[model samples]
Target: MENLERTLSTWIVRYRWWFLILMPLLILVLAKGLDLRFNGDYRVFFKKDNPQLQAFNRLEDTYTQTKNVIFLLVPEEGHVFRRETLVTVERLTELAWQIPYSLRVDSLSNFQHTEAEGDNIIIRNLVQDAPGLSDAQIARIRDIALAEPLLVGKSIPKDGAATIVNVTVQLPGIDETGEVTEVATAARALADEIRAHSHLSVHLSGMVMMNASFSEAALGDMDFLIRVSAGAMLVVLVFFLGSFGAFGTLLVIAMSALAGMGVGGYLGLPFTPPSASAPLIIMTMAIADSVHILATFYQELDSGAGAKCRREAMQESLRINLQPLFLTTLTTIIGFLSLNFSDVPPFGDLGNFVSVGVAISFLLSITFLPALMILLPARLPRFQFEIHMMTHLGNWVVRHRRRLLWSTASLMVLLTAFVPRNELNDVYVHYLDESFAFRQDTDLLDKYLGGLYYIDYSLDSGKTDGIHDPVFLHKIEVFANWLRQQPEVNHVNIITDTFKRLNRIMHENDPNQYRLPERRDLAAQYLLLYEMSLPYGLDLNNLINVNKSATRVTVGIQVLSTREVLALEERIHQWLSDHEPALVTEGSSPAIMFSHIGEQNIRSMLGAMTLALVLISLLLIGALQSLRIGLASMLPNLIPAGMAFGIWGILVGEVGLALSVVTSMTLGIVVDDTVHFLSKYLRARREQGMPSESAVRHAFSHVGMALVITSVVLISGFAILSLSAFYPNSGMGLMTAMILTLALLADFLFLPPLLMKIDKH
Candidate 1:
């Protein structure tokens, strides 16, 4: 151990400058190279072989091979079903089909209209020509729309408030971003055309329109986030280090960030929304390490220390800081790496990228920072204000040590009770803050139109030809009716409902006959007639399986919180158990999958974090060679996270995918304070043979200022991130800053007091 110390000391004294010069250059060169070649896709979040994706893809490719978009037409009141509205819908439907990627278009006018002709019904597209339709013909089209099976409830609202004209594009490899923009532009143009010629109001919705809005909003916010985070860091650095020194620190941090991201790019990683914040995270962590080293080095120089003093400062800082820094990095990596277990690809990539970035920041901090300090002037302006402030703080901590302990312990214990259960929810839409335009637009649509959340139930029977069976159809119809009655369900679409509705229509809209056919043969015959009457592009592939053994039922729900979603899901499962036990299995949809994933990740991550804390404690105990000391050291590190999380629970009841990871991550960062404080306390005790109380005072007096400065820098750096619009990133920043600040307090008061008490025993 003595030789190891000597070797570390010798390296710090002799060759620290070399690390400064080479590190930055190496990072810059590598980063640039990697940035030139990176390609990542957002769809990677779904497993490559997901059955839902496969089924959706196959169905999308086959009959509905057209790209679908919805134009929401809302008149200024009592004008949607007028002749003008019918003409506009018919005109846009025709023009939409002529668009480059469009293969087909379906609106009130173009939807295939058919009726059973005895044993068979002929299926054909309606409205052969748009401008050719007379006023009487257009009236007939509107009448057909009101009575159509799928088009009736979907396109024309039951309340007769709005009308949706769906346009389907058929082009492959269409630039998703570009296509949305083009279609939106075209829809707006058509809306303007309608307003010019008639008195009607129109808005757009559907996958294409939503995707366009989402992309635009995400891109704009990303730009703002980058500018804001960078600007905040720059301001903080200038305030702490002054103008000139701040520039150097900025350069170091910038280099570390670039290098980290560039490395990711080089490794063929794409820049995802989650991983886009990589540079900011790396920059914050790097600046934190730089600030600690520079602050301490400058302090020593201001005190009239020469080359020997500079060398000693570097050696002591490293000796004091190395383990803490290493531990922090390790904990952060573990926290991020645990994301690999997540089913979501973006989350997994984020975990891997951040873990790599943290490791890089750690390496550069120790090597590059020392080197930079050597290269720059050894003398720095004396921080007269800070020194006096820290001195006062140190003296106060020593004087009121006992009182501080009780206050801190009481606060921690009280907060611990509120640390909300590690329950998580995967509401992806909620991931975006309310302030975002996409979220605002989504809310408007949900309020005016319908809910955004959707759940798809694939009602499968073991045997083929079971779907057309009347007994099975009746059960599905019963289930659909039950769901429709529930307050949570906004809409439930089932094939049986459509078939029964068609049967009612076939029987001249008789309410009494609006029920399933009694015999399987009659049901099959009715389905065959309905299938033959369907249009060229519109088909029943999405509603029923090829062999007719399974059917898909979709349910849409209004905007709800995570807890609300869980509750609804539980009720749904219970209903399914009581009603159709074998029909539902892992209901597939973005909402359900995300909710399950979020819950699993939260539970697993919490378990892992607990294991990590225990393992870290064991390591600390073994390293210090005292069970009591090792155990005591954990309080300072452990309490901060618990306190912060508890406060978070009380303040923000919902913890999402991001906060789950923070638990393990904050553990690593907060532990740095404990390790630094305890190392100093132990050295005073075992090496210098000082009494416990005296050693606590001496240790605090010697290293207390460094601890305070480093903690402040870390806290400030992380606090800047709280401004991010991304909830996870912002929440992480706030939580980490709070935990670190509490860690400093624990280190100064509770840690030493507890140590003194233990030593007395």
Candidate 2:
């Protein structure tokens, strides 16, 4: 190992210029190749065989196959049963169907009105096909809507102030961004038209609209985050180093980021919201590694040694720093790789992409950074002010080590105990900040109409012919009733009860026929009659299945916190178990599936992170060849994460899907500080034969300034990310910054004090 180190030292001194030119060119070529080949889709989060996804696909295939967008309309004053309201509803309905890529459109005006005939129920379009309805005719339609049972208090608000017009769109494929954009634009345009022509106000809310809004927000935020983080880091580097040499270091870090991102792009990996931040993250991490090496390199050259001095400096720095740098990179990779356990596709992609990026940064820092240093002048630029500040801070740490240790420990324990454990959720509409236009529009719709988030339960009886049986119908009715009683459930739609009332009304208002049908055949006959009388666009697919074995009951839910969603789901599950024993295998809506997957992701990510930490800890022990030193090294790395989480729990109350991954990430970042501190202390003891306390002071005096500066750079880079509008990215940035800062303190104060206490043994 000594001979190899000496050989590498000689090469760095002799052929530095060759490495500097070749290394950067090679990186640029690789980056360009990857950039030309990159793909950018977000659906890669779900596994191909995910059961929930498969069930959703099945429903999508069998039922009305179209992507849907909902238009929620409201009046500022009075009920919607007026002639003016009915006319406006009809006009919007007509324009909505004319929208490009729209397969079908349904609103209060176009709803199928059903009534029982002799022995069956007859259904017909509420609005007849005509160029325009007279004012009197429109008034008559309004009166009928006010009197109708289902249309009265359900489709339209009970106050009659608001109503919804849902437009179902059929596109060629999910990736057809053009079609999605067109539909969203048309929907907004129609809303504008209604506002201009009439006094009525319209708000658009649905999956497609939300998706488009999210995509736009994500892209904009990505640009802002990158520019802000890079710009801030550059300013800091310039302020500290005060030379063109800082720019060269910055170039090396930038090259590392480009290489990492280009590799991902070359592999055809599309950048999702999380993955988009990988380049910035790679740059931040690389800066820390490069800054440390450069600081030591400059310090050695300032001592006024010759070629031998420069050669020895590079060797000593590399020998002392290499293991710690490698360990930090490995831990970071492990933490990021843990994200693969997340059910969310974006998170999984982020983990893989970042892990690869960190590896690239490590390699470039070792090879490219040294080459650049050798190519630069021996007497490089200096930061006299920063050097003075670091010296004073180092002196303070040595004096007050005991007090700092106690204070840190107490704060960590207090925060950990008080931290909240509220569940994390993904309410699609709520993901956007309040300042966004989409959020404002969605909020308005929810206040006037109902919320967009819903839980669709398809109750399959496992027998096609028995769908309309009295037992099954009664079970569904009871389940719907139970759901309505829950606070989370805003609306419930059960076709059986809807038609059963219509059948009773047609039987000369007889009380005997008011209840559910006794036989399966009678129920089937009633449904068949209703289906035949329905309009062209208004189909029975929303309420009934094609096989007739299962019935779909949709329960619209109000937006709530993640805890509320989980509690609501649990309550519904328990209610079903108690009331409907035979109603087996209930498939939930897309919204509910998102919440489930988020919760699962948190658990999986935590498990993976814990495993990674354990593996990293084991690796460190093997590398040190001393279990005592290895175990001692863990306190600086591990405690910071616990402290960060504890602080997060106290301050934030609830940690989400993003925060769950932070623990693993903190493990990797903190390890950098530990490795640097411990490696220095060990060398002072075993190689130079110093006592433990002398060794602690020697190690701190030598590497302490560089460690402080590197932490500052890392913290500054991550802190800029807190400005991001995206919740997950911001959370990660804040937590990572906090953890890195705490790790630096721990290494400077706690590690030395603890080591002092241990050496007494």
List candidate 1 segments past 4 Å from native: 36-70, 91-113, 116-153, 165-222, 266-270, 305-320, 341-345, 421-426, 461-463, 505-512, 518-522, 622-625, 686-690, 698-702
Per-candidate clash tally: 2, 3
How far residue 631's Cα lies from its native spot in candidate 2, in Å, is 1.2
Q: Which candidate's TM-score is highest?
A: 2
lDDT by residue for model 1 over 83-104, one digit each (tens)?
Answer: 6666677777766664456655
Which whole-number lDDT from 0 to 100 does residue 405 have in model 2?
66
- The runs of at least 3 residues in candidate 2 whose Cα sits more than 4 Å from the true structure, single-residue gaps closed, are 33-45, 82-84, 115-124, 127-154, 174-179, 305-320, 376-379, 383-385, 420-426, 508-522
Q: Best candidate per lDDT, number? A: 2
CA lDDT scores, all candidates in order: 0.67, 0.71
